[model samples]
Target: MKKQLHLLRQLVQQAVTHSDNTTSIVTDSFAVNQAGDLLMIKDVMIDYLQNLSFSKKPEVFIKRKILHTQRECITLLDMLPRTKMATPDQVALADQMRKCLDELLRHLHQHNCYFSCEVNAPYIEIQRITDKTFQKMTVMKAALKRKKIYSELLNIICAAFDRFHLSQQHTYQHLQYMSALQLSILKLCEKASDLDFDYQLIEHLTYWCFNECHFVDYCKSLIKKALKPHYGTKQCYEQLCHFEKRLTVQQEKANLRYSVQRNSVKYQLMVFVQAELECIEKKQQYHSGGKGVTLKHTAQIGSYRVQTSFSVAALAYFMKLLCESGIIQAEPRSQLLAFIAHHFQTPRIGEQELSASSLATKYKQVTPRTAHAMKAKLKELCQRIDDDFGSGD
Candidate 1:
């Protein structure tokens, strides 16, 4: 028992050390790489939970370790950036960590139940300990509830808006969309902060908005229509009315489906984890090997498919330029590369077909000499485009 307690203490210390290291790294840098930091914390917490699970130690000892781990996990959760600014990968990782912490608490509760039944102490003494433990657990659970609500709401909003794309030229429309989204989110947050907020209502609304209505596609179409030349206010209002009618029809259909499947264990589980599963699928696609389609083929850009071919390094450089310009926003270089590789075909460099993963790896090894030439080429392209635009006008 002594050895087990000692080992558990060491695991907790290790996790705490990792959490501190992650915090320090974020604090020291403005351009903190949250995905990597969050991943490190998640791995450490999982390791702690695994070690705690395998122990045959006394419930009292296990409870201590669980509480310590839970507290540390909450600290790590608090350290995460606000959901509005956090990348999708970071949000997913934080959600995973939250699940791990919940599992740990569940384990702790099981231990408490066993402890109450098995301990030979006076009945009142056991009752006091159990009640105190429950109280602490309740406090920890409350600390997590607000964060969970924010994360869930953000996830639903993001999913609904993911397909709504606009070019940089449409600055007015872009600002309006962003302002509306921010305002809606702010209101949702205020409501969620209230003590009497109906969390179940949020859950049901998320399901209805995300699954029942063609929400993403709907947003995309709405934006497209609103952006068309000479699209007046009357047309915009009529379009919204049509959308509402369609939404009502879809909601009715959704109600029938929900009534049928809401009680099913498997259906409920699927609905609960749908977002996580989609995130996993996206990651898998990002990391998967190429489809053997070379860059000689056309790639889709907006409504048009244009044929283009560029070497891997040239393409990476172009993507970097796009990020540097305010034309598009992407983070952490790897995501940008993956986006390019996913849309464009695999480019062959020196008799080797460079897949998405390989493309990212090769992009890093690009010498400064090669980068200079790519920069010059990009500048030349920009000049040509400018000349053509001037002539056209």
Candidate 2:
């Protein structure tokens, strides 16, 4: 029973890692299917162990080892705190671990009922035929075996704890780096007011900021995966306490606000570029003595207006409509609208191109009637914008 339990636990660990890998990418669905299959297999193993018999003397020793292992598992459950943000798959794995522990304990209790009074008198006499010294030595050997079994179990659980701890640290560092890059780009956006700012630098920063957000999302995924199991260990718990102390709830909220500020940074940089172009166009018009020049279309996103001549105004207006329609309920609705508009309406280089289908996969979906209403609203807005601007020609 001890060996079977250890082997089963190892299988579960591997399957969990596999599932995490499968769901990491947005382009694939096969991995998700395979992951589901793997989880089902783990469930079968749990059921098998729950029903396995453990009534004889040697089997009783195995039962004691299982009980000790279950205790250790219970300690691990604290790793997955209710407050932590975990992915759905990670939460399911935690639930599976808890259920397995409970099932083992329940089966052990059932086994106890059979030996409540030891009513087999002939069996008791047969057990006494052995010499007292022999019986003592056999019991001591069983105790040693049980100790060895528990030692192996501890190694497995502790190793898992350490592995996830390192994974969390790595992903956390990546998150910090992404946040820093975002801050630097926003600083550049602010410095554009000086009139001598580097357009090239802003362009590069804009591209980097847009591209690296995907990796930021990937890092978040890794963090959620490791958050639960790593916190089970004393070392990890201490580390988390220190880290959380360093970043209080107020500080986190401040950071989130700062992040939202950075959302407009790219558009603000583009506005600077448009201003430069418009200045050149005005100078050329003055030089040419008042014939005419068709100004390039530029799009605006901030405030409650479309302050540009481009088709991006239509996109921005549609996004406002989407937000007011209650499609996305995130705080700072302006920022959420900007994110959805940027990704859905104007994807930058290296960003995932999202369509309605892909958006449905990630965010909330409306019912058929609401969907039809939203579609009609979008169509009407698009027609009005097109009739007003005539494609910016």
Candidate 3:
């Protein structure tokens, strides 16, 4: 037993050393590395410990050492890049770790030392124990399926989040645990179609997804604001500031950029629009007239731009020109025009509606051509809306 403990300690040291020497970036062929070798040694130890059939009392000191080594190995395994463990060797070792974790939990459970509600253990810690234990009891899985564990973990996580309010201390580790719990619950769902999940877990997950979806929608709207045709430096700067604040808030909770892949389009769009806005701001402060910049209508759009200024209408017109020039697609052009028209509650600029000239005077300067195109697009969109959802007079 002492010899085995020595081997385990040596393996852990080797694994930790190899990991420290390696770069943080995980590549595809990591399984062939020395890190993989050390991990496999730990895997062998797990198997050896699991196979130990004792008729007599297990040595208390030896058991303590084994548990300590198991913990270090678990931590090291977690620190290893999950996505880089694609190779068979690395993958096998990972599976072995999970198996070992389950065995350890089982051992503790049989000895009545594993389950304690007093500690208020973090969800990740409980998850590590419960997930493996459930996996081990595959035959009695349905009966062993514990809703209390799921509910308890959720309560712990929610309490932590509420207490700290997502500041630096409460974020990274909490998010890591939340993400792992989400993945584990999802996997459990996939395994048993009839398995009932706790309502708290469901509600929490739903809220999380809804929050991310709202952020994505908000980003889309912000990009539209930034790209509006007559938008000037000041407006652009203000919009950028608003978007940055929201991004900071989201990042403080979780890495939404990584978790919500569908919102990547919005992220890319925001980045592009922000860069353009910064350029516009610099140009406005340096080269352009302040607060009263004016430009003549370069083109006519059914009297939409009697006089042009930089504003949302003008911005839409600018995007129309990009569309005409094949710089942007027709679908996005239509969408932007529609968005502006809906928000401003006007389809075209006229004597009755707000004049483009007045808007330009108040806001920033916009090219006449862009304003004209924007109004034209808006008019077309209004007519289409009338065709689709017109009231019967």
Candidate 4:
């Protein structure tokens, strides 16, 4: 009987949508559709409609019902502070049920399950004759996107983990707890990335925890038991703590990496700056007899000697800074400077009409030389780098 009745509602809806000029005679049809399954289908359709509506209003009654049911389950399991009545299985089952119910409630709240309002417009838009039509420019409206309550989310996740901790009392509950904590941390990072939160401490915390685990006490102890032998020895694992870093590593590592990168770029600038000076020297030699390579001087020799001189000088200075000072090791700094010099040490541009500033600007960086009057700017920069960072040597 219910199925037959359901068909009547669908049939009536189809007729109404197709109705055209039969407004009067079709009145009886509309009346039949309205009365057919009003009790059964009205709320069902409204429930589906709620999914499409986005509102900020909270549904207190529905939330209360879910909370009430969840609390009842928890109570039945005796998961209270004073009660040891809950068995391991009961605690786990109750916690899972509560989490599921709470998730549904959150979904409903996000959809703004119940809200209605009325607005009355008093004026009919009037079109005027013999008048100008004004065009309004486009405008932008700012809106706050719904933000996750991370603290609340974290608490719920911890609650679930507490149940996990209670249920098994396994050695690896510590490991699982760490997993839960890590997931919470990742969610925090995601929220910050999405502009829903502004947390600036993650980077600093990452450095503080560079070689340490975030979890301690019971959780860490549990994990220590779990990872006793089957995997990576506790020393090699370098987990990142930042919720916002585009690069990985402790904060100090990131800072040093940035410094090294800047220096490499500066060195490249120095290389090209030297090349410009060389071309100038060549032009002067061409104007005089010394500029052109004579029968005695080969172009290859001129190129190799000048390039090797600059390369050795730059590399030696860079290595000296790293080795002699406590700043860095000689090997790493030498390798880095060599890599940069290898990429940038191209033949000098012949005396084209382009000025040094224009060439540097075209490359999107300011040169230390043309932007200044110093004839030995490259040498000065290398010397400064050494003086500032150089140690005993």
Task: Please tell me which predicted candidate would have the highest TM-score against the true structure.
Answer: 3
lDDT of 3 by residue, 36-134 (tens): 454555456556555443324366744555455445544543443332343465455445444444454344335433232222333335454445433
lDDT of each: 0.42, 0.40, 0.44, 0.33
Model 4 regions lying over 4 Å from their true place:
1-58, 78-393
For model 3, the superposed segments whose C-alpha errors exceed 4 Å read 1-4, 7-68, 71-102, 105-238, 248-251, 254-278, 288-393
The better candidate by lDDT, 2 or 3, is 3
lDDT by residue for model 2 over 1-393, one digit each (tens)? 455456445534544455456543322243244345544544554554455444354777655555454444333332323322135654554455545544443444454432221111121122222233233434433433443323432243234323322332222222333345434534544443321122223233334443233333332342344344443333333333432332232112122221332443334333433453455557657877976654322345222232322133334444545566887344333334434544453423124332432333323333455455557766888989999988675
Every model's TM-score: 0.25, 0.20, 0.26, 0.20
Best by lDDT: 3
Tell me how candidate 4 scores on lDDT: 0.33
Q: How well is each residue in 78-187 modelled by candidate 1, as lDDT tens digits?
A: 33322222334433544444444344434544543321212122222223333443344434334435545444444544444333222212222222333343344444
Off by over 4 Å in 1: 1-308, 330-336, 346-353, 362-366, 389-393
Query: For candidate 4, lDDT tens digit of each residue in 32-60?
Result: 44444444443443353353343344556
Residue 228 deviation, candidate 2, in Å?
61
User: What pairs collide in candidate 4?
Assistant: 285-291, 286-291
Query: Which candidate would rank higher by TM-score, 1 or 2?
Result: 1
Residue pairs in steric clash, candidate 2? none
